[model samples]
Target: MAEEPMHSLARRFVDAWNSRDTAGLDALFHPDFRWHIAVTDHGDPEMRPLNSRLLHGMNLPWGKAIYNKKETIDIFSGIFAASEQFSLDLRTVIASGDRAALELVGDAVNPANGRRYDNLYCYVLHERDGQLVLLREYQDTLLLFDVWVAQ
Candidate 1:
């Protein structure tokens, strides 16, 4: 069978996420999938403070550079569990060969604190055997801190 196209896979990924379908994610991700939280300050001055907060103030496991498949799935599961409504609006998708990039905005209401969780994101993904093998996600950490972390 021919491998799935990168564009199709990227759309499915967005759909799976919007629906909070962990089983769909399981099917889309390779067994050895890796996740990355893209936090860098070297190039973008706007990222400096957020990166510092994530690296120093958060002190959370998500601050780690890499996450294995189970950890990635678990983190998603936790987020879904915490929110009353969680969905992403896919803005753009660019894909070629085994690589894909997605631009999206997430909207959710976190029942825990009655706070609206709205954030923008960019995800770069690599595919292997038609399944996503790696995903690097960049998002607004300040909004994350405001909604989910701050008291």
Candidate 2:
């Protein structure tokens, strides 16, 4: 069989998340997979641009940037554990060679607070050998903060 195209691989990535299939995710991510979030200015004058490498393994109230496939799996596991319903709605996907960008709407209901967690996200991905090697995520930090605090 011919290999799947990059765009199809990107869609499968979201489908794996929506299904909360950890094993599926494990297969999709490269061994060195890294996930990054662009931190927005939270009105703190002292806050500076953070290096993505430095953010890995450091926990924040909202979430943590993660490195490696294991760490990524752990984060997803935690999210699924906390939310009764978690799903990603893919709005658009664009792929060029080994890179892809996805626009998504994430919806989840936190069981602890009974609050809806809804946010838009853009994920930029790099794939190597049919596995995702890097993912940069951009989302509404304020919305994330609100949902987290409510929970």
Candidate 3:
């Protein structure tokens, strides 16, 4: 089968997040997927890694780090479980060959704090055999700290 266009794949990726569909994500990601977050200076210095890092899961300061597909699914499951509503709005997507970059904004209310969590994110995805093999995610770490840590 021909591969789906990268932009279309990116849309489906957002859909998977909005729906909290693990199976859909499994279908889209390669068996050995790797996700990287570009950590920044902000929040407690404790949260920053001593060195560069590549990890799975959302890696929010409040939770333990998760490092694989199953763990990632579990993390999202917990997020959905605690949220009254979770949504991701895709602002733009640019693709070429097997790579794509997506700009998005996410909004949700965590039942634990009744605080709204909203942030902008950029995802750089690399695909192989029509499946996402690598995802590099960039976001405002300070905003994350404000929402998930500062309280």
Candidate 4:
């Protein structure tokens, strides 16, 4: 291996995800990968874990809910931005290689209540055949629910 650049690895996943091409997105994930979502305190030490790609991919409703997947994942190394809204902002700064990881930091401002939600997310990724095929992330699900229901 030529020690694939983190930017390349990150972009590969970001491009595919923003496109929301299930097949294309699937292409980036490891077959047996997992992810986690932590909702509450961004640094909440104790939280439930969730499957990365599988959970997100399995949500067919998002595709319908989202009018356009306009997002950006700035690539890095060992990680990628899994922080996107309905595929929007799919572009995430990530890290790649043996242990790809992505951290998403943002505020979900609910227009209804004018509440800016604080959130933090991390995606621990795994690759198959030189491609990211799995992911595990930690995020604020409560904020996610608030943001989601608002949409």
Model 3 Cα shift for residue 126 (angstroms): 0.7
User: Between prediction 3 and prediction 4, which has the larger lDDT?
Assistant: 3
Which has the greatest lDDT?
1
**Candidate 4 stretches greater than 4 Å from native:** 1-6, 38-85, 88-97, 105-120, 149-151
For all predicted structures, in order, the TM-scores are 0.82, 0.80, 0.77, 0.47
Q: Model 2 Cα displacement at 73 (Å)?
A: 0.3
lDDT of 4 by residue, 28-132 (tens): 545543332323234333534445764542321121211111111112110122333323233355554566566656444555556566667666665667765
Query: Per-residue error at 105 for model 3, in Å?
Result: 0.4
Stretches of candidate 1 exceeding 4 Å from the true structure: 1-4, 40-63
lDDT to native, each model: 0.80, 0.76, 0.72, 0.46
What digit string (tens of lDDT, one per residue) describes model 3 on residues 18-128?
Answer: 988878987887877656554533222234443335333335663322245666656667777878578999999988999999999989876666677788999888888
**lDDT accuracy of residue 67 in candidate 1:** 75
Q: Per-residue lDDT for 42-148 in model 1, tens only?
A: 22212333346445655333546677789888999988887857998888888888998999999997677889977999999999988999888889877887787
| Residue 52, candidate 1: C-alpha displacement in angstroms | 7.3
Poorest stretch of ten by lDDT in candidate 1:
41-50
Per-residue error for 42 in candidate 4, Å, reads 17
Q: Which stretches of candidate 3 lie over 4 Å from their true place?
A: 1-4, 40-66
Task: Report the error of model 4 at residue 27, Å.
Answer: 1.8
Clashing pairs in 2: none
lDDT of 2 at 13: 88
What is the Cα-based lDDT of residue 37 in candidate 4? 33
